[model samples]
Target: MSKPQVLMIGGGMIAADQILPSLYQLQRRGVLGGIGVCAQRGATVKALADVEMIRRAFPGHSFRPYPDPATAGDAPHPLLYKELIAALPPRQIVIAAIPDQLHHDVIMTALRNNQHVLAVKPLVLTRAHAREIEQEARARGLVVGVEYHKRFDDRSLLARRRYREGWFGEFKLGTASLMEKWYYRHSNFQNWCTSENSDAFSYIGCHYVDLVHFITGLLPASVSVYGIEDRYPNGNKGYLWTDARVIWNNGACLNVQNSLSFPDGAPGTNAQGLSMYCSGGDRGAWLEHSDQYRGLRYCYTQQPDAPGSTMFAEPSTDYFQYVDTGGPGLEVVGYGFRSIDHIIAAILRVESAREDQRSTILDEIDAAGVIATPSNSSYNEMVMEAGRLSILNGGREAVINAHEITLR
Candidate 1:
């Protein structure tokens, strides 16, 4: 079978850091055809194309930048992705790595174009939108996978298996945190992650929320989020700090704290981890993951040029890292790359199956639960919707009953 062409709908930090390189590696291995990336402005795409790390790592590999990077002016072309999606051949792949609010439209566009989609976490802001996408994709026999990279982490997979086997018992209570560096206040996040659009919990904290479900199979039943509003360097206000309480259906509680307030000089890129306490009748159990620090510490002679980088670093080997394997460039390792590769491989599996059996293959993919799909992961959207409503309403409790979300 011929390889399916790939189109990336966003060229921001994720594209440069994880998605594009993963795609380049697949291209290197002959798993993909031509790859193209389209962004709001030519400058964003150009910046991704000019990333020195990517150039050195991938060697001769590059993506076709949309809007003609040379002639397209500084003005933003928000609808340009529509045109590019329309032109792609049927049953190709489209990666939606845009903002939280824009995921619905871009994903819908891809599905309408007869394309398989791999979206970043928190697929959409609302459960209704997630259901809509799920229905549309299922009707057309297309696969829609959410890129919750944490699920691919070995720690998470092991915990999931053990927990299911009654090793960790029933999760009774937990705490999680994922605090990004303070420098995020100055990045493009200042423009989009505003008070009206998203908050710390809805943005980064959802990882733990999803992780909890991915590990325990328990659905979040209620959410309450208290957000602290702060001004970015660009003077835009956002919910930069947040504290949330999530109650599972079985009466378990998970407290999650998130913020863009980690000190710039901190040893790790970010501080993140999960600790869960479970019950097993006569005994108790526990699970903990210090994800930010992976036991490797380095006191470099010189600090890196990136903002907020530190001379003393505790690099995480489980997320995304480039290591020399005596190759032309570098080999990308970690759960980040593995997550993207897994979704693409699932797409390839469906495509390789007989046309009449494609639906069955998609069903099996969803049932296997290895890769997150709208049909199986819509609870994430429900939690996001609940979090947003609670944060906006002064931390009122938002109850999720059946498929609806309401504040109390």
Candidate 2:
């Protein structure tokens, strides 16, 4: 069997930061075949290709840009990804790294084309779409993995194991926050993450929601999100700040706050962490993770040219980074790369098996719950849907049952 060719559907910040570099490393390691990237505009794909960090980290590695890198302009070809997905060979990989609202269509396109998928977090905005994608992929015996990279973090894995072993008792109350830097206002987020489409909670906050479930086998029963609307630099209004309360099935409550309003000059890239307090008989246990400050502080002579970067920074070594290890090009390391590698490996595992055994492999991947498949992680879609509903309706309570999400 030939190595699977990989095509990324969106060339945005995530594509530059994690996905593309990870793919380059996989290509370098002979894990994957040719790579391609399709974006709405040629400039976006060109910019991703020209990223200095990626270029320095992976020399002699590049991707086939969809809009034709030779013709450089801001012309938008919104439907180009459809053509590219159709052109790919069956049983290859198609990565959906686009906006939150666009995940379903792109993922369905891949599945319909008989291509496996690795979608960004919060697979879709609703459980219905998730079920649709799940049924489609399962029927075709293809894998669809959601990129909840935080689950790949060793801390999360350890906490999950320890908690399940009765070390931390049962999760009772928790709080999690992930705030992006203020500079995000000037990016394409201003256009897509508007009042009508999505909010900060639905975008970044879903990580913690999913993480809580990943750590403890609890399902959210109700959610209420109060969003504060603010305008971007482009004069478009969005729910820039959000505070949410999620009630689990065991009557546990989790408070999640998310925003793109963190000061750019702050020492860390963003403010994020999770704190869970539990109880058992007369004993109480606590699990706390200061995700933003990873115990490493650097004072540089000059501030990095990267947007929202500070001269004195608390950099996280766990998320994603490039390091030299006696090689012609730098190597990509961290949980981000691990998450992508895991999903691609799962796809390869399924593809390598005989046709009759492929279904069993797919079933095993979903049952293991190590990777976030549509079948295993559709609760995230429920939360996203409830969040959007609550945010739009003045933060009313949105209840999540087995079948549907309704407001109270």
Candidate 3:
């Protein structure tokens, strides 16, 4: 079978930084064939026309402005689901990396149009929308995956293996945190950060939430959260920090703190860590730290004060340092890229089986001793809505049951 084609939606940071780069790597390796990008408006789409990195990587590919610039130029124009779907091939894979609010509509539209979809994290704002999309995808017999890159992280994957083996003994406490530089909110990417549908919790906290679930296979029973909205002068007016307690069905709990207020001048650099304590021993087998390193000269500096800058070194971790720069191999095997690749491979595998009149993709792959699974969007959406309700109710416990949330 030929390599599957790709139609990437949204020309924002996710598309540019994550989707496009990953696709370029895959394209170089002959895993993915042709590629296209589309955005609602022309401004952002036009800005990507001359992107050197993308142009250098994908030499012959060109960006296509969907729904026409004249019509979708305004903010929040009429939903262009029909028009957008009409422009793609039936077997094409739609990568929806647009805003959080539009995820449900775009995903459902693509699935209903008989195209597989790979959506970004925090698939949708609410569980209802997520379930609606999942139902549509399942009804159409198509693949729908949510990109929760943490699941593909080497350390996190190790933890998952150990947890699945029942080596953790009994469920205990899980602690996770994610911190961004103080200037992140004030940067050019604040467009979606200020929106009501997206915030620090969904933006950064979703990683840990999904990580906890993916690592331990625990279903969230209840959640209680307290979050503070951004109040800086130019900061986006949304949840800048979130603290939450998630109770699993096994009576174990997890404490999560996500913040976007880490100053650049602070002693520690960006904060990203996870620690899970089991009942078996004093030492925890699960600990993933992406902060601080030794003998690293990389530092933070505003100006070159002397021959060598004396600015403090930012938190440095070689988490994604494995790359074969010289050849046509998996140049970048970071979890972020691996997450996207996994979904694409799954979709293509299913498509290939269907073309050969196979009974089922799962059965076919299983007979061949292949094990592949993508993170469930519905599950992530359910937990996110529960967290939202917990924050809305002033940290009151919110209950979750099989991808549905109820404020208790």
Candidate 4:
């Protein structure tokens, strides 16, 4: 059978930084095939530049580009969707890394075309859209995945196992804090930073939202959110910080914050950490990853940087090694790489089955054996919209239902 084709939608940071890099890595290992890209006419230059880089690096591979104009003379020109539908082969994978709002439209089109899809989180902006995407994929026996990459992290996988084994006891509370340097928001994503499609919490908080659910198997029943815009523009312009208190149906509270207001002098590009408390049966267990260091911290100290500088000390290092090959080859593992490799493997498996007259079943299980399917994104979609509605309703509680979302 011919190698499966790859079509990447959107030429965003994710496509350039993570997705394309992983694809090229797969190509290096002899697992990838022809590649295609689609983006808006405005993004053509960037998209083509990326394609050219890949083409030059890996010669002899077919790379096609289709730039779509938002509108034409007559009907709306969804050139990307039209071209994809008309030409996407059965043995193909569509990586949807577009803005959050367009996830539903682009992903649904791919699924309706009977192509396997890997959509970046939050999969869609609403629970209904997630359900529709899932239902369509199931009906066509196609695989669908949401890029909740954190779930593939070793710490996250460990937590998931402990939760499944009832070792974490009854999950009582989970608090996650993550912040990116100001440059990321004000510069990196400046284009659509405040377009209502992307926000600090919705974009970054989706990781923890999905991670908490993935680890504890709890669903966010409602969310009470309070958002603040410190330096960025306000009122549909952009949000610099967001804090949400989510109540899970299992009587667990999840506190999540994603701030794009980190000080410029900060040491790292981003800081992230999560702490979970539980009812212990035997002895209390504490697991936490130090912010910025990504390792365990033992103590803190106070030492001034300058006369008026803030004194801070975290006795930690980037010593925690999740995977070490001691070199580079096909068995080298890291959850980030594993997550993308999992998608590639799933696509290849489906392609193999189709070619050998075997059943075409694209399993959704991750490397950790957890069920990391796209349907699990329903809660993510809910929490995102719930937070948005909460902000719109003056920071009141935004209730969510499995069937629909209501702000009260």
Q: What digit string (tens of lDDT, one per residue) describes model 1 on residues 311-376?
A: 999988999988899888998999999999999999999888888998999889988887999998
Pairs of colliding residues, candidate 2: none
C-alpha local distance difference test of each model: 0.94, 0.94, 0.68, 0.68
lDDT of 4 by residue, 60-89 (tens): 444465553333223323455557654877
As for candidate 3, its clashing pairs are none
Residue 45 error for model 4, in Å?
4.9
Which regions in candidate 1 have their CA more than 4 angstroms from the true location?
Answer: none
Overlapping backbone residue pairs in candidate 1 total 0
Which pairs clash in model 4? none
Give the runs in model 4 whose Cα sits over 4 Å from its true position.
42-62, 68-78, 230-236, 295-333, 354-371
Worst-scoring 10-residue span by lDDT in model 2 = 69-78
Model 3 stretches astray by more than 4 angstroms:
55-62, 65-82, 232-236, 265-269, 281-288, 291-324, 327-330, 355-359, 362-377, 402-404
Model 1 Cα shift for residue 126 (angstroms): 0.3
Model 3 residue 278 CA deviation (Å) reads 0.6
- Cα lDDT tens digits, model 2, 1-408, are 588999999999999999999999999999999999999988888999999999999889999998996885777999999999999889999999999889999999999999999999879999999999999999998999999999999999999999889899889999999999999999999989999999999999999999999999899999999999999998999999999999999999999999998999999989999999999878999999999999999999997999999999998889999999988789999999999999999999999889999899998998888899999998899999999999999999999987788999
The sequence of per-residue lDDT tens digits that candidate 3 reaches over residues 1-408 is 588777777777677656777887777778887777677666666666666655655556554555456556656433554577766778678888888877777887787778888888777878778667756765666777777666776777777778778787556787888887676666554666663655666678878877777777777788888878766456557777888888888898888888877776654445677777777565544444453333365555464342222366542333333354665333545666777788788777777775544336644433332122222434567677887787767778888876457787
